[model samples]
Target chain A: MKKILIVATIFFNINLLFAQSSIPSVDVKDINGNIFNTSQISNDGKPIIIDFWSTSCKPCIKELIAIDENYEDWKEETGVKVYAVSIDNTRSVNRVAPLVNGKGWEFEILLDVNSDFKRAMNVVNIPHRFLLDGNGKVVWQHTSYAEGDEEELYELVKKLAAGESLEEKH
Target chain B: MKKIILLFTILAFTFSSLQSQNADLGQIHGNFQMDAQLYNNDSLIGANVPSEKMGLNSYANFNYTRGKFNAGIRYEGYFPALNGFDAKNNGVGIPYKYASYTSEDLTVTVGNFYEQFGNGLVLRVYEDKALDYDYALEGVKLNYKPYKGVYIKAVYGKQRYYWNTGTGLVRGIDGEFAINDIIEKLADKKTKLTLGGSFVSKYQADKDPIYKLPENVGASAARINLYRGKFSLTGEYAYKINDPSGVNDKIYKPGEALIVNATYSQKGLGIYASAKRVDNMSFQSDRNADGKDLNINSLPDITKTHSYALLAMYPYAIQPNGEIGFQAEVIYKIKKKSLLGGKYGTTIDVNYSRVHNIQETQINDTIAIGESGSLGYNSNFFEFSKEVFFSDLNIEISRKFNKKVKATVVYQNLVFNNSVFNNGNYHKTIYSDVAIADITYKFTSRKALRTEMQWLRTNQDKGEWGMLMLEYSMPHWFFSVWDMYNYGNPEENKQVHYYYGAVGYINKANRIQIGYGRQREGVICAGGVCRYVPASNGLSVSITSSF
Candidate 1:
């Protein structure tokens, strides 16, 4: 009877673990070392842009820099904020500061050095971007970067920022 | 909290399905590819694993969608990974899982993922299934667009290693705005162009007392992509700071790496050229690193990995500590209606790449972190050293004689440093030649017979070899058999052979295959990525399905 109870307990625990594996929330820490829970970073009445990228991807850089160059102008027009997450590990951590400072970017920068945040999101490739709305609901996403893709991304962001009902794209 | 997440998943699925109901929602679609083999270890042939064996390897991706959101997962089961990738196989759970929601310009993903930045010289998180690898991050991603052609993103997460998270934490930020999207002048056809740039950085702690590494490092890049009707050019210049500790023998030289790639593509003709120079930049998770030893921050030698059997054997490994290299590839298609072109037409590809060590000096006898000028030896760029790390020169020609017959011939010359690429003793250079012929006969619209023949010759390293395969694939079933014969060897005792056969059945979303054969010993590299797999022989099976 004791063995049976122990086996039952083991299975129960495994089930519990697997159940919690879906959409696990995380206390994200940005490059500033400030811990921001999901609620703190989420936009209340506006759309949020979340880009999961690393310092080593060429295409991800292209996508990110293109947005940064016009970020100030974008915010004035749409009032949207981008939360950039870095997945660099110990070895490449040293390059983080200089690179960001030199580029003069103004996005909300965070760190996932241990990749805890990345795992929660189930990211398969860099330049992985996700769009969330005022209700903290995901609205759009894409997996790769191609020329002129940003234009499509902007049209969606603009509609969301304007508080207009989003018409699904076919 | 758990209920909320579950509700989110259900809602996301429901929404995506609603939108995709008539457009293939709830339907599964993805790519399936594999490379299997057989091995024979003859006692007199100096085989590493002397046993008759066979192996099967494959990867499959499945997706299910609802209305405004979707959930997808990848299933990869390799019964004894490919020839040289025994280490990547960790007998465990499914390697991928994720649920996402997207509507218009806003998107969110809460699960595992992958990412990267400029040239990956400073940071990159990705997965190449062909190499039996997956580097997905686990987290929540948000993407927002504020303007017509501008976008921003924020992600918080951890990287995936097999089924678990990596040791250190990872975080970053990146943004891009389109010029042509916002400016009317830039959108004109006469000067149609788009220019963008990005800055990204990662952070981790120096937990081990062995090295006083930076707590937070940021890397950035600038790029411009100009495109017209038939001509396009994209280029990015990146820079990183001095990262010193254990990886570089405690050498205090700052990690400096740069890469530039430009490509021009036309209707049937394409040209790609890239160049890179790196100095004292052995970027790795553990400062005390070993060849083929990766713990994250692995920027494989930017040098191209050749495809020819010989050139690929000793393929060049990027000298992260110091190296310079460039690669150029041109692909041209022969027009069918033009003179000198046959009825079916042909395509020709020529590619070449080479790399050498970069020179630098130590500023002080003991180089410390953050110390700028004269910290390490400095040398002129574009200089070549006595050591020729890696080089590849090859050309491939493919011609389709008819609907049932096609052939491809490749000739290549390669110089590889076994010490650098193999993480083993002895630096060996090898020369090789490879030829392949494939033909197919379609018995009906749903059934076909295909055959392939390949031969690889070498003078150094392992030996000379030949391979032949015949595949009979129909609507629901397929079978294949192949043989690899080691005909010539510099070492009389190193001549061995291998053969393998496999058959599978495909019914819509499900497929199964099984095989047994001998495996060879070599490094398998695809798309500038590589892994070492050991020789093994065993029975393998695969099954995939969706609900």
Candidate 2:
């Protein structure tokens, strides 16, 4: 009986909390090893896309490559900025810079070496994406990726850029 | 129970008041994961028959955040545990909970937490659910940033072992300083420098009958990193005081480890190299704990992590006691429309890694190498013994034939010493060659088909093996089937086929997968950490979701 009550209380709390939500503040490092808070990622009325990835995840690489191939067009269309966050631990962190340089990806890359930001975002898998509005409010989120999944992300970015509310559609 | 209810009611009322004020009360977010398997006895492959016949592992995390305050609790359930997991993890409860608050320059956490220092050579407390390994510390942690570039962290706790705390106390402190940011003058320079150091100590009362042991053992490490333009270099060294443990056969020899890595990259080419050596450096929280439990420090595995089935069969496991190894890799992209490059250009990746035992000399003519109650052996820090432990050389080429199709081919040569993995019974080294071809074709914008064909040839252990996998994926659904056959086993009856099939559905942040398969016994490794997987015929279901 006590267990049931505790579980019920948790669910009630979750319901109340989910009604008011925003992107949590977490510290991450850029490619140059400087710390910056996630709350400071706001743009001047432009949408931002954050992609969580790792060097070992194939789907993540595919998604990033696809987005990179069309990043210029996306930026031009929606005035959007993309941040590619790598959750590579120390074992593979050394390869991240070289890998990014070799691939010639133009998006800003951030390193979450210990996965602190990942846990704060409640991300369970790689290739996860979060779409934040111009105000730095998380509007939409998606996980996993198949071929051509980048199109959906771009569509949402375009919508967010047009001052459309994602609370209804998403 | 009444007090609990009253407290929850008060919290709920407070949140309601905040909601009415139109303030950003807080956010509650978490993830849920469940894996369940139903097994069938298979004596042919030496699979153990479980009386329960079914196992389930599940966890749900709940996190609440309001301004600078955050709290979380995780409920874990392991009914009968999994086949490969330790039997002690057969029950379930809320083993992890924490509350933390962050001010402008300081943060404090109470309850359970995970931490790592430097390259995790001196201390690391983490959890890996896949391996049923959870060593989160239950205590208090503090983080303070005194200056713009100086950060210090300290923690004191007892490690969680299954549902209980280990019989030891651990305390650690670490500090990191960014030299460029600290001095302010070098901040605008092109080169970056960072220095860090950590000290960790574990206390476990000595209760042995034979040899006298130190109740407290300490380890310390220092690291430095430098980065300029397209080049970066990092090095870390650690030292531990003499402490007898099970992994080292109760030897009293002190431990030491050193790791160095460097990388240089350009637009189309990247090169990376790393070297590591460890001597008697197995630091666990408990002196008698074995397997993957109570590990307080982790050694970084410099070898490449393989994802392909056949390529991963002979994965290397880091020998924490004594090993010297190095790895080098190069990735190059051929220019498009060049002689060697096609329309879409080609990517070439080559990697090589090798590990050998550290040079060891007997302390004296009277005592054998690595004997208990003695210094064990004297090792030359820079010298490598002739005894090869493991080596691998692999190359891969990927190309796009058209806009709708892409393919990759890989070949690898591996030399594995079985004596290190298996007790000493299998002392012979096995050499194997592997080949793999992976291709994916897109039928439409939302439809795709991918296939993999792999083969391995070897004369030792299980001899030769072949595998084929096909996967079809759509926007919302995916289906896959795979089969692995051991065809060249010396005993005809030993040759068997392991087949598996799975279907998955994905909706936003949620995914569900169901698979039924016959598994073959093998050692599964990730980041040089390994666990033995038992053969079983079973149906498995997995689900994960986040909000």
Candidate 3:
């Protein structure tokens, strides 16, 4: 009888939580020592790109560097922002700054010391990328770093940035 | 009535959420999965399980994350397990529960988790589904990165014993450094190197009134990996102190192992080879454990996992306590337009593997450690032992003809030891050859037909076998028929086993397959995940989907 009540309470809470859902909110610390609110990262309801990556992941680093090479052009054309979230925990955390500095990556970087943000985003494998619309709703997600994948990503980002409804793409 | 209502409510909720576009509850999306099976008695093939009437197994996992915080729960279920398995598991329970936080340079995980240190020679906690094996640890793990290219981890945990904890505690530390990244000035597109090392120890409170046993047993290993252009090399060596209990008995013995591998690949060609030597490295819980008996940590040998249907039937079981083995594999693709490449190009794969006992002393007397006397007599290292464990030589070729058709052919030769590898009362030696040919032809852009034929011949073990398969598929539907004819079995009369197969489909995310066949009981490992599926002569159905 006691166990039954406990299970019922838990289910009730889960159902309630599911009903009041909105854009996911996360707190992340940037590499430059600034706490950035993920829900408010992009201004004027612009589309945001979140790249979950780690230094040990070869494909992630390559993808980031490749994007960095063309980041300036992408921003000028689409007015978009890319948040490279470093999922490197304590075991690989110290390498985060050195890796970024060494690679000359100039994107906004945040540290989720406990993977608090990674879990909120449902990231199982890296490098996972999520595209958010102006209202901060996840519109698209893809896992793994592959060649030419970023090209397709940029096309979607541009479409969202143009205020074009991207819900049909999913 | 109440139970049915609750179940219906649950199903309705599940269905409704699956149909909704906003089903994801916040940033974390999680789901649970489980699979179970029951074994029925069959006099044929000697599977007359009397008391062991039914077998059940299940597992569920939950994942949640928000920002830098992540947590998960894994619940496992087992009831009256299969033969040779412990029956202590009879209910649903939490085998693994953990919460972890990752910062820029630091991560901490508290609770139960699986980990491996340096090829798992000293410490490894893992699960093999095919083997009905799950060894998880309840512990706390810490990872710290002090600098670029350097990482360190410290972990402490107690192994799980059914619903309880093992008597022993395991502690380990591992560190790795990538020199190429650390010394960026010397880094280029050409040269790279990574170095790692680990130390692990296990401790159990002494509880003996007569013989004294070491309270603590420890092992350490170091590894190096170098890569330049198309060449790569990796090697690790580990050593553990002598602590023989049940498995080794009154005989006191230490353990040591060496593993080395090298590979070079470029363009359309790839080649790899690996060799390992182990001596008295069988570390387990309850030293008295025998076949189908274990209470603690046991590391499975790292060896090539065969892929061919027959080549994999009797896979090699690493003899960590005493064994020497090597494997070599090569893959090549005939370049298109080349003289031998033909019009559509061809891909060929070749693999070979072998294992044997290591040199050992047959001394009957106990030798004290560090004594001036030689511990044991020296024996030949490369010579084959009286027992042949396992051997395999296989090759496969695949080709594409135009855009409508593709075909592949596979052939393999295998040698399986029945007495040691299988639970046969006598030496079951099987020398066999198998061949399979598969072809796929497309009639339209989204319609296709696939056909397969396989033949296997042998004079030992399960005897001769043959298989035929046909498949037809469209955009949202697929149908298949498969038959496995067991032309022979060493213990049973030669008879052909026929299996009919059929399947219904939705989209890629949902499909249901039903089949009736003489399913061979064996271990199946995919991407390092393993599970044991028992042999059954009944209907088999599978349904899977992900939204």
TM-score on alpha carbons, each prediction = 0.64, 0.94, 0.72
CA lDDT of each prediction against the hidden true structure: 0.58, 0.87, 0.64
Model 2 steric clash total: 0
**Which candidate number has the best DockQ?**
2
What DockQ do you compute for every candidate structure? Answer: 0.03, 0.44, 0.06
What are the runs in model 3 whose C-alpha is more than 4 Å off?
Answer: A1-170, B1-26, B36-42, B45-56, B79-86, B208-210, B285-303, B364-387, B490-513, B522-534, B541-547
Full ranking by lDDT: 2, 3, 1
Residues B428-502, candidate 2, lDDT per residue (tens digit)? 999999999999999987789999999999999899999999999898799999999999888889899889999
lDDT of 3 by residue, B42-160 (tens): 44533344254555555545666555676877667666554434567677778778888888778888987666554566666654444555566788988887898777889888777
Cα RMSD over interface residues, candidate 1: 15.4
Against the true structure, candidate 1 reaches a TM-score of: 0.64
TM-score of chain A of each: 0.79, 0.86, 0.80
Q: What is candidate 1's lDDT per residue for B346-416, written digit by digit as tens?
A: 66767777876665444456854324333556657777666666777777676656545545666666666
Better of 2 and 3 by DockQ: 2
Candidate 1: list runs displaced more than 4 Å. Answer: A1-170, B1-66, B70-91, B94-99, B102-105, B129-132, B207-211, B281-317, B337-339, B360-376, B437-451, B544-547
Report the C-alpha displacement of residue B5, candidate 1, in angstroms. 29
List clashing residue pairs in candidate 2.
none
In order of TM-score, best first, we have: 2, 3, 1
